[model samples]
Target: MTITPLSDATWLAVAGPGRPASTTIGGWTLVGEVFNRHDPAVRQIPDDDPASYEKKMLARFWGRFIGVRLDGKGRLAALLRDPSGALDCLWWAQGPVTLVASQVPEWLARSAGAGWRINPARVEAALHDPYSTSGDLLIDGPAAVLPGAMVTLNDGIVSELWRPDWLARSAPALSDDEAAERLRDALDQVVAGVLKSGGVLAAEVSGGLDSSIVAATLARTEPDRVRLWLNAWGPDATADERPWVDLLAAHIGITATCQPRATGRLTLEMLTHLTLGIRPGLAAMDALHDADWARRFVAAGIDTVITGKGGDSMFIQPADAGVFVDFHRQRGWRAFLSRANIDLARWNERSVWTLIGAARRPRYTPAAIDDPNPLLRPRIHPEIARHPWLQGIDDLGPAKRRQILGLVQGCGLHGASFQTEVATVFHPLLAQPVTEVCLALPTPQLTLGRRDRALARRAFSDRLPDAITTRRSKGEMTAFYGHLIADGLDVLRPWLLDGRLAAMGLIDRDRGDVALTRESLAWRGGYVDIMTTAAIESWVRAWERRLPGG
Candidate 1:
């Protein structure tokens, strides 16, 4: 059985390549792969012997705890219950076995030991073992221990495989300083690895802490071979990335060209939407359009793009909400209920939605948490929660850390970014050495909230200029000339107003108006979102406008 939850959900349960994993177990449409979940019920077993009033009690318990049911043929379907016998979690329904997934100490009381296979490779093709189909990104979970290997999946496609060895933690782990040095060395190895395999020793330096570290390490190793490029809306007159790019260039003392070009919201007139179904209207479209920016590096003897894609998500922790939660937990419930200097309630009301709402004209409503929210636990998705490592996301306190783990773990919408420019994009920070140890280690060693990426700053203290290393605040490289939104609005006027964006089946037409307005007013949205849309539209139109069978 294929174990991985297919990235393209429609392909699995919908059409592509799989058997319908369903039947009327009790009367309800026992959706085999129910609602983006990939688990199955094997069977159900009973617990107690017949006592005096056992039938009535068992019937009520089964109905409530397990959601038990009967088909016209009297086939049974019910949820699994905990030891005290409560409807705690889903059941792996098989004959005579009542398997339960409880958050407490014990689980799987009487059922056949539920088998879980988690495939962790971001893409299954990378796993190299065609026999293993779990499709999870990390083998099982971050803490899941597995052996690295070279396995042949199919003829002609040999892939490298590495699994986490959590047991290694039993031995002495590298000290914070040692860990930093080891990480730098590992990064250096990756740079050589990429180049050795006829790939590129390149990085997309966003001047943020993440990419800056990569860029600095790479430059120190091979400054002469290094080529740097930045996405600029216009020339230096607009201050388009000239300041930071110039700083980096001078630091490396290399002829780093910022390659300032004008691939605004509507880059090419005829071409509109981009590949991977992104609208040239969003920030991803900008990257998709700028992906051609990669052609220059390709010409400059570079073949791959090493990037800090998951760096921010994996490396940094969000502002502390734990202060409030902890303060409440220790001091009193009243203190916790009150908003600390920082709280989720305030943030949701302040930053993202507030600004966007003002310009766009809609009020924001927050999602209400009903049951013991997934924010409190990982078992919300029974199948996904199987790997003990995902439990880390749960154990993490405060909502910010939880969100960060979610972003790092669940890359469900990565393709929406519309990054087709570079051949290969590597998030080396997600490299096993980096994720398992470097990130999960002591936070004070790396960063102290808004203090700084202390670990990176200290390691490269001598190499990087103080301007770069000491930088606490981050910026959007395109923020300088993002004012071009008004200009792009003029250019894309026909496409947006005429409902062409919708007709193309790319963007949600309902949202097209608001998105167009955001672009028209030069009201800065988000760098990621705006660029995504711009890139998608340009690619789609370029392909469509390609000389017919040229």
Candidate 2:
């Protein structure tokens, strides 16, 4: 860990080799990886106003970073976080001093000593809405510095550094081919930039469109840097993607290491050893899978693992009536009714009349902070705290609003929070530059008012296999997760039924018993709730054991 003093009162502490070294640029101390859009030219903050500084910083640079500047008296003036959330910044006030770090610092825990206890509100919030990006920490006290926001240290005021609405308002009018070319350029630059930094990289070739595109891009950019191509297959045909993987491997002229899905089966012992974060992040079922892959990446001395994680959300992959709404609003009734309506209808597999009605009065709602688990005690569920990005989206068309919400939801993705012990997992698609370009495109252009990720297919068509670019079906892991939950019942049932969560009255014992039965497990949706509950239970146990009196 490197600690750099910004002022007499404030200091910056950064850890991990994946994080770039802190550098002083124009009197501001910046930490984490930052790339200046205007290369070779440095822009200085015009004044001490946090708002103005934030605006200038947003327009000039993009990456996973945090910046801080000092006042004349050698005190911290302002602090800003990157828009992509590629790095985490969490802070809590410790009397006159405000403690800040990427994650909860161990020193604070040691300071609290035996007095530590899990934040019940955060636990309830997580159980209520596991995917929320609210700034609450699982361990009480510390609050997170949300992505694309800034803070005034003296006044303790926080404000947005970047807004989603700005991107929407500035969306350029471009033709299909023009938009595709621009997107292609953005994807290439982001991928190439990461490669230029140099590292022992591995790309996940999941045989899906997104991962395949990433793999193809990596291969074309700097193939020699990518030492491995990793793929995981399942026993069931639905979970297998070996054929597509092989096709991509052949196209890229590289061999891929494919392993059985069962190699990472969830086990009770694994849960106990999980490196606890600010919250219960890893899906209980995916705990072993992530650990297994982490071990492999570490053993191979891989520095980074790139995956197409945010493609679904970023590419607007969901076929919904929102696309029709966006088209109708933007292109006028004549164009929408004549061409877009039919195209969207065909895409959604719905009749034109149904699509029209739904578009006129879209029923799709944002993801609510409510748990579907029958075992959860609803009374303790916390009040819904909407993420900032979801605000002012009511004026947006259904498709665009859902698209923004999808991005917001992606912010809290398990992979975003989960880090391998040593290797850094990078989602190049989620980089700020690529995200801004995609967000600024019209929804119709993004999906062609028909197929999901239509523009993405057009963008990388020349480089990737035709089968992968046009592939509609995705590998299903429903059976894999179902079997995992079924097999782990003996361990999961006792662990959850007699766990800390139940003792705290957060779970209904009677309901949990009914939900964990073989009869309940037969239903496809039942396993998800069970797995979610088990995750929370494991988190509670892990933290309790770490606290003094437990």
Candidate 3:
């Protein structure tokens, strides 16, 4: 990637291996991977019509990109990421030098002056939910552009271009059958497009509904070019997911290779080499993938690996509480009560009146609870917590609301940091066309009769088996994460209690040491929190190593 200065007031950061081209539409200079989906070498951008170009860019349903356009004379610039943010773009301003790049570390390297400082409040917010970006740039003034957002920089001020009202306008306009047919067609288009130049395509088959759908679709469509891979564990391990995996492979007439899960003593010393380049604030669990798998892909000449990630996000999986609301709004109180009672019974929630009250309200109000932080919680500024990119958007109708929430929460999206190291991970479910259709699906078609992902079940019923499609209970990785921490807790000790977070006054060392005991780690959500906290610690250490003095 090279940072090309377009003009006195503007610059473009180009990354990846594509032959990027630039075109001047009106007064704006547009650059980055803007190409034809059918022929990447061919530019599909409209040169004569600026308005048409804007429409096409925003409405693009597929392909990878990090496009930017700048009007230097006007002192304005715009940045856009792919729909799922496959290519990440980060920008930070230090004095008069403003830097943006696909890699955050690269941008920081070019930063001049006093250098960047950690935002303790941002660190606290990241600990709250590590999976979500939470709008923290982790620096004093640097900011990250959110997925699907179009950010404009005007006179040093940056603002995002996402209208919630615009998304609500595209609500489901077709019947159940029509929606199913369209979704299937869109899935086919996305999957087929991804496999068009297929060379040793492999997919992660977890035996779950979503992966099954993707694996089965691939098997049916491009059986000759694809293989299945499963991350296997001992039968005694709660993370074991091979039975269903074998079942699906047998049904599809394909062979699957099971890769052993990564195990053994976990320690900061072992991860020290990896910490320096680790993406700040990402959960440590994200880095827990088996290295052997990537090597296997290389050995087998696999270039791309398909996954059923973002399936729930795109399809708006069955909502436990909100389904009642959709039921009441669509049907009368009678139908709402009937479905609510059944769902409540399934969840062991026994208040029909309470359910009705929940349904009456647009969104459920959670009871005030104690903070999840085990140590002294850092004081965070209200502005930091309420960053526009981190804030919840309102006014989007329920279906579209679910989809956008999933995207913002970052479902099915993988980090681009490892794009070149491992086999390219493709998520057809998150394809713009598929995601748009699924978001437009009527709420009833999604959660009616207490069936989650009903649209998907109906759409790919023939391709998947009855057992796989009908299974309702999803697997959890609590045991898996618990064991990961248990194996490495000793090595992660110093960082957990006395790391950068502690030095920043974001956590109390004494209290954190007491709170992070093995006994406490066994509690529900405890392992996950510990893992995330450790990740933050590792990131802080990484930053310390990269910057001046410890």
Q: Could you tell me every candidate's TM-score relative to the true structure?
A: 0.48, 0.90, 0.82
Best by lDDT: 2
Compare candidates 1 and 2 on lDDT and give the better one. 2
lDDT of 3 by residue, 459-547 (tens): 89988878888886776676766667766767766766767777777777776777666776765336645666776777777665555
Tell me the whole-model lDDT of each prediction, alpha carbons only: 0.38, 0.73, 0.61
Better of 1 and 3 by lDDT: 3
> Would you list the clashing residue pairs of candidate 2?
none
Query: Lowest-lDDT window of 10 residues in candidate 3?
Result: 33-42
lDDT of 3 at 218: 81
Which ten-residue region of model 2 has the weakest summed lDDT?
38-47
> How big is the positional error of residue 263 in model 1, measured in Å on the Cα after superposition?
3.7
Local error of candidate 1 at residue 194 (angstroms): 2.3
Residues 280-332, candidate 2, lDDT per residue (tens digit)?
65422376677668778888889888888889878887756777777767766
